[model samples]
Target: MNEVVHTSPTIGSNVEEIVFVIVVVDSTDRERISVTREELYKMLSHEDLKKAGLLVFANKQDVKECMSVAEISQYLKLTSLKDHQWHIQACCALTGEGLCQGLEWMMSRLKSR
Candidate 1:
């Protein structure tokens, strides 16, 4: 899926904070696959996400045909994942359900650490 990156979003009262580029990818089924994180980790696990300042948001959780969060995580062998503390959640973006909380959690997770 194509994504448009949002830069310097005023997430809450936080002013001019650095926001990571958000890469959008499909929550897959039909076959097993690796997340971009895994791809990067295979290429360089020691170079953790902090080294690259990367964060992932695996979205599209409410599609009728979309895979469950566990399925996506397992198919990607997310246990092999590292660096970034990201995972999928059941969401209906069209309805604004769970998006804000997810975004807030992301902002806090990346910022507080």
Candidate 2:
């Protein structure tokens, strides 16, 4: 893959190539759902990350009040991201569940590229 360097004044002279982005959201935090969705939209819309794969971890799946992966995906407007490849995984950080599946999906995408 060709290097897609990113430059930021905050980290001056330290450029890194970005191939993909991972966003972890708290599924049990109902109040912050909108905020999380908005932030994700902003990131997906960024010009610098146009070609990057997006992996969203809908965490805290073990919580009874947590949102399901489908609900989170709908609220995040993931369908609008037609130009990029993305996936959302329901996970329980405490139990280490679904984490490997998420990473494996990411690796598959990278290998395909």
Candidate 3:
């Protein structure tokens, strides 16, 4: 799993702020799930990103053995993030499925903030 950090320009704001963090996970790789979860925790706990929303792309959903979105969310302990805003999207990079929804969620989060 590759941890990706993305900063989007705030809506109608000139300054670019990291209103959210995106983590791209290889949903098919179950062995690395725990490590990925820990890495995510460390990243999100950083003082610089304490208030950042989380957007997780559960990649390789096209694969038959890939973990389901629910499974990924549970394994990542997303429910425990009561103070943070988050969304887990099941996506296939090959076909670009679920990408827009994730971005839209991020944008909504930014707007809400």
Score every model by TM-score.
Answer: 0.51, 0.81, 0.83
Error of 1 at 77 (Å): 2.2
Write model 1 residue lDDT over 23-89, tens digit each, in one string. Answer: 4446653442454545645543453335333333456676777767676566656576465555454
Please tell me which model should have the higher TM-score, number 1 or number 2: 2
CA lDDT, candidate 1, residue 89? 48
Error of 2 at 108 (Å): 0.5
Per residue, candidate 2 scores C-alpha lDDT tens digits across 18-86 of 578999999988889999988877887799888889999999999997899999998888888898899
List, residue by residue over 1-113, the lDDT tens digit for candidate 3.
69899898767757767568899999999999999999999998999888889999999999998899999999999999976789999899999999999999998877776
Candidate 1 residue-wise lDDT at 33: 47
Order the numbered candidates by lDDT, best leading: 3, 2, 1
The reply for model 3, stretches above 4 Å from the true place, is 1-18
Q: What is the C-alpha RMSD of each candidate to the true structure, in Å?
A: 12.4, 10.0, 12.2
Q: lDDT of all the models against the reference? A: 0.55, 0.89, 0.92
